[model samples]
Target: MKTDSQLQQDVMAELKWEPSVHAAQIGVEVKDGVVTLAGEVSSYTEKLNAERAAQRVQGVKALAVDMTIKLSQLGKRTDADIAGSARNILSWTSSLPTDAVKVLVEGGWLTLSGDVEWQFQRQDAADSVRYLLGVIGVSNQIAIKPSLSATVVKSDIEAALKRRAMADAKTIAVEVKGADVTLTGTVHSWAERDLATRSAWGSAGVRNVVDKMNLV
Candidate 1:
């Protein structure tokens, strides 16, 4: 285990190392095992990248982000322009269905709403729009269509977790009610906990995942 100070150093180093993030503008602080990031960022992509970089540090138990987006003069885009760009990009994405996702932008904040068959498509829709030039924030409200029963969904998630090389699949419990999943158990680290949750979301009809998992 790493001390809070060591964890803070590693997270700062990771922020500096990630090419997409502007580490100088961000501040990192750790208390116990939780890491909090605060400051300003250039774009929504930078914000997401910063969060991911912090999570990559070995001893980060949890992350609390308070960064705000402050677009430079050259980076500004009208909400209409952002909406149009988001629509165009979603339309071009091969993985997403034709016109399945809808876009709305307000004050540089973008929101996606609609339905998709799989979680990856829903995720891809958000990913495509998140990197747009003027996007400050993204809300992925796209829902997954329910296509599997509780039993099948549970089994599928369990199987996926077992297949992951580093995950102790037996330590996690998967509870499904229709398309909703609740994960409850203990994992070795934050990475393992994330892997378990991702495995849960990978199932066909998981519309919502409630993570009640605790780190060891």
Candidate 2:
């Protein structure tokens, strides 16, 4: 395991390497295994990319994002324009249902809320708007309304995991309480952990997914 200082340095280096991020404007701090990002960026997309870059570094257990977006005069867009663009882009996305996601923009921040049947659709709604001009931030409040029963949800998620051939599929325990699913187990890497979590969220009728998975 890397020390806190070493992890901080690696995160900073990673941020600098990512072309989308203005790393010089961002500050990195690490303690224990948590990374806290501070300072400012040119846009919301850059901030998201910086956070993703930090997560790609090894030994990042958690993240605290304190960075803010400071859009240039030319980059600024009115809330109405941002909302209109978000709506137009969302309508263009095939994966998302027509008007299934509602958009709210305030202070250049976009918030999406609605119900979708699967996690991918909800994710698509957010992805469609993140790159829009003048989007300072995004809040995806889209909820999942699974079409399947509780029993079916468990079986379906397990089957999905097996189909993906996750090495720890057997060790990963799946629990469904009402529309909520909880995953508990150990995986070898963040990739596997994310895969397992996605499997749970992919199931029909999974309103919420609780990840109790730990990296081994």
lDDT of each: 0.92, 0.90
Tell me model 2's lDDT, rounded to 2 decimals. Answer: 0.90
Which residue ranges in model 1 land beyond 4 Å of their true spot? none
Clash pairs, candidate 1, are none
1-115: candidate 2 lDDT, tens digit per residue: 8999999999999988999988889999989888999998998889889988998987888889999889999899999999998999999999988889999999998999999
Provide the TM-score for each candidate, comma-separated: 0.95, 0.94
Candidate 2, superposed: residue stretches over 4 Å from native: none
Residue 1 in model 1: shift from native, Å? Answer: 2.1
Q: Model 2 — which ten-residue stretch has the worst lDDT? A: 185-194
Candidate RMSDs in order: 1.3, 1.4
**How far is 17's C-alpha from truth in model 1 (Å)?**
1.9
List of clashing residue pairs for candidate 2: 146-205, 147-205
